[model samples]
Target chain A: MCELLAMSANVPTDIVFSFTGLAERGGVTGPHVDGWGISFYEGKGNRTFKDACPSSESHIAELIKSYPIKSEIVISHIRQANRGCVSLVNTHPFSRELWGRYWTYAHNGQLTGYLDKFKVSRFQPVGYTDSELAFCWILESVVKQFGEQEPDDLNAVFDYIAGLADEIRQLGVFNMLLSNGVDLMAYCTNNLCHITRRAPFGKATLIDTDVVIDFSKETTPNDVVTVIATRPLTNNENWVVLNPGEWKLFRKGELIRS
Target chain B: MCELLAMSANVPTDIVFSFTGLAERGGVTGPHVDGWGISFYEGKGNRTFKDACPSSESHIAELIKSYPIKSEIVISHIRQANRGCVSLVNTHPFSRELWGRYWTYAHNGQLTGYLDKFKVSRFQPVGYTDSELAFCWILESVVKQFGEQEPDDLNAVFDYIAGLADEIRQLGVFNMLLSNGVDLMAYCTNNLCHITRRAPFGKATLIDTDVVIDFSKETTPNDVVTVIATRPLTNNENWVVLNPGEWKLFRKGELIRS
Candidate 1:
């Protein structure tokens, strides 16, 4: 339904190369031309750029192409609307503050009957989209569970989330990627793929458009990068396909679970 | 502007502890009620949820609180619209397919005059938002630079991106975080913060909202985690503050770059 791109590297690297090829699908190669957004983590902060205009024609998009905003981790998205109206308030890669840290999230599937299931206390949807409503509901759930103090059990928390996801998936397709500032996570109920780059670099080609890049020339012996997407962006590379009802955790260009 | 939260851990951990406090800002404590999103990497994919509604009032948000969804890497976001129209097409945490992987992206700052500069050959914005246009432009640029091959020189690419970001920064505030699946890169032009968690677990408390969580009980002795945010997520924990024009790279919950 949409496209996703993410990179986790050992060094401060630019996603321009991969991003270039993916941009084609925003409106040209594929149908996810709803909107686009990308964030480059510089240091303690990040440099982000977003636009509702098509990436194929936006001047700002061109600027990002030529720019080398490097980061160890990066996330980018192009949307194909399903639940929310086509507008900025409904754009992917939504953000919020939790425990003082900035959390970023993006989704790529529809949640049937999500509106009825989700409800917030103080938070209310600004736009009429099931995706956003779901986000708020998740936040409220966490607050209710921990009651201010951060939870110490990580596995238990994940289990709880998995249960929720299972429930949501039953309604419809639910695929997504999320990161705060530290690590990245991806889940796929229908279609999702991923690639991890290590010291031994290789070549990759864009599937939507005719674009390619050699990793050997762009990385050192110590660089490790991992990318996650709803579909394989490159036609040549052996992208890892995720099974239905699958999820993965990545840190420093390595897959902890599959 | 929007808020972001991320956590990287050596062992599986739950974010509910921190999420509890963060959810407060979704309209309860802060004003980022436009929408919210979160993704947790469980095994190979991720468990993601979003809501067009406020985190405080969404049923999905409440579900997240009750859910466990423990993950080594997590990304969450709450939005305050600035660019795209308020709708689902404009939601954050956009996902796409690239290089046989799912890529996710989210942004927090605004970019003026982005529409005038971006032009995508294949990728076009489905919705009308500056964030989406930027994402497409970056994707297009990557394709243009390296055709059918991944870049071998990451440093060169980073430099190129940095230059591009500098240009974009001239337009407006550019703060962001990006990750593919391996490592994380954080850049701060304005306000962004981060903290790494390792062997020694500690206690944390939320600043924007009144919440606290102790990590020591839930983590193993060898646990290592890192958190990143627009602002320090915890008031008690010592969060690293990024300098203007500074960037940091992370790998496996450890700081690779200062």
Candidate 2:
């Protein structure tokens, strides 16, 4: 098993504080030390930084923690190497383009014998990781049903993805976070939690590291930022834990569906 | 116009020395200062770092210069935007997945009305740059000729890509560098140069910066390394300039086809 983190914001926001807490777990505070990756959606495209090294000791992760890259949507993961060997190709937060839109995905749990179940199609996995294979299958299924372009009914698309998520969950734990620079979807099989910070933002203390941040000072009243992680990063703020086999869709920091 | 840089080597090599010269051209020593990006292939998958700021001043570029992420294949670009706005989405080098392998591309020239000429198909451009549009068209054509799997006859694939490069060059100047991790292809319309360093390695000096490196201390006699750029990066070394409408394919630092 690994760890997952994601963010959806109404405005461009930095994940420095939240990511700092998660980074600690990548080798410092927790056992997830295989590798780590993060993707930040700027517009139609997103930039990703990945390292096969432990995030706590990675120079790239240090750069990420110090450099505040503001983005509306973000997805990140810290791996523990359950299924695949630790390598750059096996790093999480895998990305692919569909319907002219860049899609990013990160998974936290292992799915045993996934290759035998999933059928390969237009999209193929460059890496041997089960997470990447599952991601490729999901995109292949989407393209099969809706053709190359994104369907007119987004609810239908969400429903399709949720159904696929449940199917993937049958094999093993399948906590996942996926996005297309617009909608962020989190599906839980074992663990996932989310918290939305808005107008009356108060001080929050990190659970993993010795850090406290005043959200009110950093955010405007109009800003709505939702952060989702495999485990809650902050102790003071209440995080809504997702039940097993439950999935939620969020757009611009607001939960649109469950 | 932008600037392009690429490398192919038999052994895993760090491009810190060549990249330093190119980084200087991004703002300090030259005018191509809109944005910059680079892709380093580790295996079938590649990791890309991009910034919407000038490479000379970008924190990410600074990190790249300091941290030596060794790779066998590398593609990099610094932009002086003309067609698209200076933003992360429009930064080169653009990448997409094809045949389960990550394919990266960077271009140094423009096509005025690429949208009117090129037809969109399986692959589409996330960014509205002619370079990306041309890249999409090339991949679409490849998929049309060959299925999802890479063809066994690589020469046929290279010929197809060169044909597409010629077609895009008809619209405007189209100097490009493309790779699928294993093969590095450089297509020239106006400016492109390459230098291969091997056994008799000696001292080399950068043109844009006050830095010199002695290859004698860096490599074994068996190593073969090729560096491709929009212009000669080193002042002391003799670089081979590609002719207009010429394209070359390199694998493991050796020129396989032209």
Candidate 3:
């Protein structure tokens, strides 16, 4: 399995600091160094950087550390390559267009027999990877449900997604992160974790490597943030662990369930 | 609108490097400097750090640069006050639990007149942000569709989510990102961008800040990675731009649409 990370904040914040720590694992700390990618959301568009090398040794990863790209919502991944060939088109954090907005997605687990059930129209896989095929399958489902026109009911759309996830989970592990330009949704069939930060800041130390940061000094009395990941990155903070076959929704650093 | 940053790699990677340039915008490079947060995925959980202050001036942000935490996936956010006050409850990247797994979500656009229609039973908002309310509303819809039992079909799930998104978009901008532990789903009603990386490498540069990195030096001959963002992060790369009303699904760094 691979790992996942995400953040939701109230202000334009830089992720370079946190990214610096993760880069070490690309080739030094952990074994996820098959490939790496990052995406940053600007006003209406997004900025994305990716590499097929270990983030720890990748020059692109190093540059990302010094770049300081800010965003309100973000998603990232590191690959271990279980299903597809190690190619650029098979990297995590894939993108597509729907309903006049950009949709980004990434996965951390493998699914069996998915190809047997997955199908798409004119959309073809740029690379021969099960992950990309799954993404296209999802898009095809959306088009089938709403046709060319977009749906007008948010609830209906979510219900449809949940249904799709449930079906895929049956095939195998199906942990995932998904987003449009507006909101974020998460599902876990195997492993996942998350945490929310609000006022009364505290200190945190990384678990995978030696690193610590005091958030109290960097934050005001009023600020809220929420993060999601496949594993716990910090050693000090109490990360919330997710059970198999679970899912949640988040926005603006808070949890909202309808 | 707000901004989002994400990183994924085969090995553990840190976000600090890219965040440095982004921090400048919190109050310097851009206007999103209301608050910030970051999350890194480790083994089965996440390590997160957040602050309400502008990252440009925050000591915590600096400390992150020096830290060496590593993970496969990382998500970071910088806020721009839109709905809700600048308080802890009103940050981005909200998180929640359902069916045992942890879920993470975030939003970039506003949802006008959403408060009146969105409603939830077992789940309620801890904050007063429209984004949170939307999240809850989506969850509620899922529960209503599938009840407590998991759906039997994956395509059905995607159809439901896409339908819900279409419905919500009618209310206003509905771009968003969501994930569980298996896959990532992205929806675009307005703007979004994404890029993928694999074996053959290339060079790229940051658009918002002055920075450049080469992938050829860091990556192996076999590697694949993808990234999604609100806007293109690099000035030299040809990032795939999302059209209005488009959505895509990703699994294991590959695209899959039914």
Candidate 4:
């Protein structure tokens, strides 16, 4: 099993505080110490940092903790390595370019015999992991239905992704975080939760470490930031847990319903 | 114009010493202060770090200089922003995956009306840069000629790339460094050079910065390393300057002719 973390913000917001909590769980407070990675989306461009080393001790991870790289969308993962060998290729938050847009994905649970059922084309997995295979399969599905151009109606694409997620969940646990820079689509097959903070935000305490941050001081009245994770990072926030087979679409910190 | 740097080695070797000199050229020694990026290939997987800030002042660049994240192939660039905005999307060392292997590219010169001359289809440019457009067109050409599978006889592919580079050079200055993890292909239009270091490695001094290193202390007798750049990175080394329209392919630190 692994852990997933993501963010969709109305403004260019940094996830340093949330990532600090998650990085600690990579080895300090949890068992997922194999590897960790994060992606920051800046406009149409994305910067990703990945390593096979434990995030708790990684020097790159330490830079991420202090560097405030702001982004509208972000995806992160910490892996425990069950299906593939612990290497850079097997690390999660896999990314591929589709329709000229970079799509990133991270998974929390293992899928049994996914390679046997999924057909892949156009996109291929560079890594030998179920997560990367699943990502390629999803991109293949998108390419099949949408071709080289994205659909005019993004809601239609969302519904199509939801359909694909439902099919993937049938194989096994398939909690995932996926984004194409503009929108973030998360599907929960087992355990997932999210929290959106806006306007009059208050102080929040981290669950993994004794760190508290006052969002009211850091954010303006117009800022809206939504964070999704396998588990809630803050102890005081009222995170909305998703039911099995449920999926949600987020853009600029707000949920969208098709 | 931007500056390009690359390394191909028989063993996993870090470019911290050379990169330190290049980082100095990013802002301290040269005027290419717009942005910078680098790609490190670990097996089949590649990790990239990009910033729209000057490499000389970037904390990420500092981290890269100190972190010994060794790799057999690397491509790095420091931008002066001729054809695109100074943003993460426009940063050099653009990459896309094809044939289940990640291919990275970096350009050091401008293209004249390349958008009108070249047509992009399967591979599209995510950023508004002539360099990215050229890379996509090159990859598209490769895909059209070889389909989704890499040719078993890689020399055939190399010849095709040399032909394509010759054509692209006709349009404008087309100095480039491209790699698919296993092989590194560098095309020179103007101002490109390379050097290969092997048994009985000697001390070298950087041209852009005050740094000296003895390769004999760091490398084994069996190690073979090749360094390529827009200009010679080290002052004392006998760098082989490539003629205009001349390109070279390197595999395991040795030149593979087209």
Candidate 5:
């Protein structure tokens, strides 16, 4: 019912080009027109911009498009309002601090009876969205299972997340993007695709807008940048769709295989 | 040292004019130019804008100045880095969620050996800053003393905060502005001032800038807006200075008393 977009890069990079394509679908090209939000991680902290307005026409979104705030990890969402009211509090890409790291999350699908099924602790959802409630439950479970310290074995953590995603998928579609400024995670049940661009990156044209960008001119030969979205933003790029119940993790734009 | 600014209003009011004056102090008029940040509460969730660059020269600050984002509670800070490095993570107006409500804080002074003295649990600081450490301690203490739920007696909570402020002030100057979207608290150890403007408002001129705003034209008769800053922002208005170790709680622009 919503759109999700995220970026992971070897170096600090801006998502202006990719975000532009997604912003168009928020209102002009597609039907998701409720609200939108984006988070850019800078080390342990993150800067977030959220607006309860159509991203295609929002002034904040316009600023984000024009100004280039480079970051190593980024997550963005455009909402269509499936479970919560259209307001600033119910905006997507919710964040909470855990393990001395800021964790940001965005969801693209709806869940049923999530409040009754999920168990929450330390982290609480301030908003009334099922997406936020699910995020809180995930974080609380992580803290409870792993104690206060950051988990040592990332593979085990990813496997745990995959199991949680499977359970959440039972209620309904569970597609999500989560990051802790270091590792970017993507879980897919219904719709999620990703593309990684590296040295041989050439021109890529947006599917929604009449815009073309030559990544070779903008990026260094060594730069590795990966973008994940609910649907492909560029028609020319080969985006790999994730199988249902599959979860993947990326660090420095490279997928970490178990 | 840093410059702190906050506002509490009976209705959702824009603090653009006041923020403009503070923005001038960030680099144009004053030396506190390491970074700046602001938190605007829109119900339980708050929207934050932070920049490592000086506010006077930041594009984000320009957007904040031009756009009118109305809020009932706001907390802002302009840092002259002393205790922490000049980066986005070290920026002031640090925020965390507790008791299902977002708590935001900004400090105007530095503490010595804060990490050694402050006791922290449950809540942790993502960034390395003496101010943020103190905030974590306060929130942790509140949770440890109180329970999971929001305290029933707000006055008791304020008193508890005042006691914690006193303890933190013993280390060094500890002027701070804290809020939970519903209540705004000001703690003073050295420099802090406040002015409440209601009906029968008059013209006010900024001390840091040449801009002048007529409050009577912009405000309604029923509007009550109270602004707290490290120093009086306006040159013509009378600002009540707080005594050392004094803490004041405000709700809906009115000072709360025992």
Candidate 6:
């Protein structure tokens, strides 16, 4: 059990507003306070800031709040330890390199016996967590299926990941966010919601705190931003909660319906 | 081409004092302002802070100097780009996971046609830099030689890496620092120095900044700390410079003579 937050945008965008709401849950409003982490993808490179302390009190988290690191794809998580000990290695938003591209992953739900059932190759889990083990299993399967080259058909990759997600969902709750700087994936077994803000964006308010921002003032007409979280972050936005065992793929903030 | 700093200690130790000197070279004292990165190992996990911004003026660098994230093993670099563009991907201190352990590397010198000489397999470089390519090749070679299990004999691995370093040095300058949380390795082709501080510690002043710290007051008598850098960080301490083909291995802050 944890909390997940992710973003995909047509342009380089900062997730300070949504992060403020989700970070509040790390200790202030929710019980997930063991640790937290965030990854921001910029071009071929991405930056990750993780703290073993709760996000509500971590100095690095405070720096992340103050620093507006803009990126096109971002994935974040705040954990409440279920299986692994509280340490830096067990913190979420784990990353690996595949196809010469860095891929980031964060899970909000727990698996029952992933380490016992799953097999890992190429990508191995550095920490003792079922979430990381599942991620490693997924990547290992990807490498086995696709080799070092990314599939030419995006839909084929999407369907492949969808099948993987369905299989993982049978093990336990499998809500997670994954991205490789360009492609964003969301898989939900129990809890997850997403909202996309396009050209005629309006003001939004955080449900956790009394913070509001006018998107019109902050974004251009061409900017398209999509944010997904374990729960709805804003009070007024219409977030779409997926059905159980459902998965979706997005690129540059646009949903891939295929 | 750049400045490098590394530390290995018997106990968790912060490098704020040495980092202050090395960071100054990013823009204030020298011209390695293209990018900078530092990795601090905590148990099996490591935290890396990278910025394309100059370390002399980066807010993240300021946080690093202020917050004392103590660790037993650390590797840092400030880069002046030669083979890649001045971007976040081209930053030094590139890392990859091998045998479920995160291996960090930072190079201070340039290579001539490393892409032609080195053959990378199993591991791939996420960044377009000779340094990253070299790191990938080394890790690939390590995996190829030792398989998934680390060698029981440390000297054999050290000798293997030494041979790899010698081969790369034939291409060009190859001063670099490498670590896998348990062991720290240093190889010098041009500029590098090392100093070990233990009992009977004394005050040391920075050469790049007007800062002084009394190690006796800050450390226990039994503590052993080794600091390695492109140049001596302290003005008063005597540092041993390695020969062009010399390589040293350290474990738990003690030099491994075996």
C-alpha TM-scores of all predictions: 0.50, 0.99, 0.52, 0.99, 0.98, 0.98
Over the full model, what C-alpha lDDT does candidate 1 score relative to the true structure?
A: 0.67
Q: Candidate 2 — what's its lDDT?
A: 0.92
Off by over 4 Å in 6: none
Q: Go through the candidates in order and give the C-alpha RMSD of each one to the true structure.
A: 24.2, 1.0, 14.5, 0.9, 1.1, 1.3
Cα lDDT for residue A96, candidate 6: 86
lDDT of 2 by residue, A47-105 (tens): 99999989999999999999999999999999999877899999989999888889999
DockQ for model 1? 0.02
lDDT by residue (tens digit), candidate 5, A14-60: 99999999999889998889999999998876999999989999999
Which runs of model 5 end up more than 4 angstroms from their true locations? none
lDDT by residue (tens digit), candidate 1, B108-225: 6888877667876434454456665665566556556654334666445444555555665676776656554444566677888888776577777777666666677777787777
What docking grade applies to model 5? Answer: medium
Give lDDT tens digits, candidate 4, residues B1-258. 899999999999999998999999899999999999999998888999999999999999999999988999999999999888999999989999898889999999988967776797788888889899999998999888998866788788778988988888988999999999999988998989999999899999999888899999999999999999999988898999999988899998999773
Question: Which window of ten consecutive residues has the lowest lDDT sum in model 3 chain A?
Answer: A120-129
Q: For residues B1-258, what per-residue lDDT tens digits would candidate 2 score against the true structure?
A: 889999999998999999999999999999989999999998775999999999999999999999998899999999999988998999998888888789999998878766777787688888888888888989998998998887789789989999989988889899999999999999999999999999989999999999999999999999999999999999988999999999999999999999
Q: Rank the candidate models, highest DockQ first.
A: 4, 2, 5, 6, 3, 1
* Clash pairs (backbone) in predicted model 4: none
In model 3, the runs with Cα more than 4 Å from the true position are: B1-258
Per-residue alpha-carbon lDDT of model 6 for B1-258, expressed as tens digits? 999999999999999999989999999999999989999999998889999989999999999999999899999999998988998888878878876888899998888967777776567787889889998888888778887766688578778888998999998999989998888999999899999999999999999999999999999999999999999988899999999999898888999852
Query: Which TM-score value belongs to model 6?
Result: 0.98
> How many steric overlaps are in each model, in order?
247, 0, 219, 0, 0, 0
Q: Could you say which candidate leads in lDDT?
A: 2
Better of 3 and 5 by lDDT: 5
Q: Candidate 6, residue A150: CA error in Å?
A: 3.5
Best of the two (2, 4) by lDDT: 2
The residue ranges of model 1 lying beyond 4 angstroms of the native Cα positions read A152-156, B1-258
Q: lDDT of candidate 4 vs native? A: 0.91
lDDT by residue (tens digit), candidate 3, A1-258: 667777766666666656766666677877888887776554334445666677887766776777676677777888888877665546677765455344677887888887779876423444556776777678768777876556677557766787888888898888888776456677888788888878788988876667677888877767777778887777777878777767777766676642
For candidate 5, what is the lDDT? 0.91
